[model samples]
Target: MHIESDQEGYRSCVNNSTSCQAYITYQALQDDTLQPVGLCFRLSVEQLAEALQIAQYLSVALDLFTSMDCELSSVTYIVGLKACRGLASEKESDKGLYLEKGITIHKGVKEHGFKTDIVVATNFLEMYSNCSSMHHAREVFESMFSQDAVAWNTLILGYVENGDYAVAMDLFSIMDCEPNCVTYLAALKACGGLASEPESEKQHHLQKGIGIHKKLQEGGFGSDIVVAITLVDMYGECGSMQNARDVFDRMIQCNAVTWTSLILGYVGNGQCSEAMDLFARMDCE
Candidate 1:
């Protein structure tokens, strides 16, 4: 049926495989059904794991990558890394397991000469980041063959996620490429993270946050709901209740999260009456 050449067949294979349990795929492998279906990326185990990723069967994909899969392609490494990242985000109880598997997959990727491949490398960086292994994540970023905005965002996000706010903002300043939404999001998060610093430090980041807000408005992202909400939150964290209200007023649409951000800004700054008034207004709206 030339499944490899048929686009519809390719899609069907992915859909079917995404629904597959590890045992089902394993049994299918044992039964040689893949030889005929021919659409799971030309019958490759790596492709099967890619399909499993769509269903977020992360552990199942890892099991195949670690054990049953004999042929390890670059895609297999990426799948393994992504699965490791997914697992890291799942259960706090298994933190060691996620980092260990991620490190192992990285070693295999290097051994197989895929360490320089951009996709594989970026996934490795993300896996390390999600595990909060910023030291390893920074090493991966530095070793990448090329650093695009996506890679830059991943590293910055890793620092922000790890509460290294100063380092995150420093990266934002020096990224070689233009920033994207993810970069801006990470930057705002860093600015927000500075709220607990001394007054001078907090005010310094507040100005930077304001600068970023202006850039977002110029870049036509000021009205982006997620960005606007985050901007509001950043201002709130910086004790700039009026700035938070300004961003709130500029948003084209306001969700509950958006409304709550501004209200919390007032409450956090000790403006109890303003918080109550804003909450009442939100209910009316």
Candidate 2:
């Protein structure tokens, strides 16, 4: 919780307290009521875990849920798991505590027979991933009756985080569907984690990365500048300066990352003058 006093009349708010119950819960969570600490949490299910008023938030959610008369589905579980993320971020001890809470809620949803729902499975995978339990995430993912790109990406991300780049790449290889920008980004990051190969062997991954880039273009998913930047980094890291330059030149707009990667690539190749020039240009921009 935090507070601020400005030139205008003092105004305060709790971060995730968009609703009245949220505000009440925020106030109630802390022992001190007269002096409310201004705190803001992310306004999502994962973030809601930190609310001072868990019961209130749940009550509000339950009321609206009942009023709508919509069946509780996997979507609800996913949302709540997402809120767990916020709670996890609060502290290291809190991270495990919140994750356990999220798991319990997810288990309750499953006990009610929504276990087959993909969204719920995805959320479970996500929660487990955040909890640093890739094995649990994989278990949930494998049990999923329905899976989609997001599910794949979540698992891929978990593998990447676990430093199992080879397994991440294998997952990518076995994916029977086309990779999206997010998928490609995760794979590219995994490539960075891979063991250092000889220049010749590194060239193979470079070719594959370029192939993926072309596929992205052909699929018309060109708006992801992160993908473009990662390509430059991948090629540069692999000692392929020419390919790095090609990608750098093709970008229509250059952010700090693009400029830095290009500069670093030039520096890595002993092109000090070119790197300096690029750095100067970035400063001007």
Candidate 3:
């Protein structure tokens, strides 16, 4: 009875607090004050886990999952892994701690025999990707995969992030599904990365980047503001000011990234006056 009282008191304190309400309790999930938009939510553990993770109450969600007496499902594990990423990114000092915790959660999933489940494996891949744990991400990729683009894109993005640009492009080339915007972006980034290699690679990188640009247009993604901006960056990285300008000219809408990349391309090519002119236009626009 004493322990029950303390638990209730703790729940009450957390429920009333504005910023530090990080505790998890079944009763708390039912409280009127905490119901989202005033709707009663008698959420199951799985649903509450997802809800709490979406709300950025990451620690609270983990607590709820860990405290549950029933058998945990794959959805809960997926949400828990994502929450681990949230905590890892919430602070620079605490990143390593949460990454370690993510690995531990992966261990539990393996013990529960969900390791063979492709959807669970994909979320684990995403968690490892977010933490830039490429080694673990690769392991998850090899353990289970499908012909869908989502898993392939996540792994490709992971390689691009870790600066394994060659591997990134290779993965993109071998992907079974038609490349999507994310896949193209990662591949384009890989092409841009090659410009920093030996001078012998510059022409090759530029040509490959052009191919990607053509593909983007063919896929009707070239006009997208972000993709166009990345195209400008890829051109600048490959030392192709003309191609950069071509992309800029074709842009239906431009943002600071588009303008900045164009200006930087000029500056990189020793055309400081051209850069200044573009900067002036940017400032006005």
Candidate 4:
């Protein structure tokens, strides 16, 4: 009876304070004491686990919760997947465990009927990609009923991060959705990576980088500072110092990275005098 009173009092406290509720949920999940209250409350617990950064415990809680065949929400799946991603970023030994949990949660997402939610699907794509599970990521991407620029960008960036620049470029070319700023950014990164490949691959990537630059200008991203800096870096890397200078001169505003890129471009082209002149101008500004 005393324990029951304490439980009631605690419930009352949780009811009155949002932070207290999150704390209790977090503690319950952490201790593996969370009962099958309902799907909504279980999801709240999962969210609290995410907020508390106890990703390993979150994965365990998710496994325990979903095994009971409890109803699942899109929020539950997304948060759980995010927690798995967090765990995957930890030590190598934990990757197998987290990856297994993540796969189970992926299956649960389908069984619990969230397969059609585009946002959830996109997050699944990102989670799998970050975990170095490209096969699973591609599976999620292909399973989605609808694809948006965000989804495409996620997969493209995932490929880029995995050092599969060629595959990333291939995906970009086949994307039905229009590329956004992030898409362009990832494509530029892939271009940079491609430029560093063997001699046979160098000219091809440079041309691709130039093509992407033209597309950025046409798409009205010409003035984006990051994009402009990327263009300068790309041209510099490709040994096109004149193109790099052209981009640097057209910038409405130049940051440190922009200045460094052009300076290095001149130096890389063996024009030390021009590089010094540019450095002097930068110092004056």
Best by TM-score: 1
Residue 139's lDDT in candidate 3: 85
- List of clashing residue pairs for candidate 4: none
List lDDT for all candidates, in order: 0.80, 0.66, 0.76, 0.75
Residues 114-148 of candidate 2 have per-residue lDDT tens digits of: 77877777777777777776777888888887678
TM-score of each: 0.87, 0.70, 0.81, 0.76
Candidate 2 Cα outliers beyond 4 Å, as residue runs: 1-21, 25-76, 89-99, 195-201, 267-273
The lowest-lDDT stretch of 10 consecutive residues in candidate 2 is 2-11
Q: What is the TM-score (0 to 1) of candidate 4?
A: 0.76
Measured with C-alpha atoms, the lDDT of residue 20 in candidate 3 is 31
**With candidate 2 superimposed using the best TM-score fit, by how many Å does residue 260's alpha carbon deviate from the native?**
2.1
**Number of clashing residue pairs, candidate 2:** 9
- Give the Cα-based TM-score of candidate 2 against the true structure: 0.70
Residue 183 error for model 4, in Å?
A: 1.9
Question: In terms of TM-score, how similar is model 3 to the real structure?
Answer: 0.81
- Which candidate ranks first by lDDT, i.e. highest? 1
Sum up the clashes in candidate 1. Answer: 0
Better of 1 and 2 by TM-score: 1
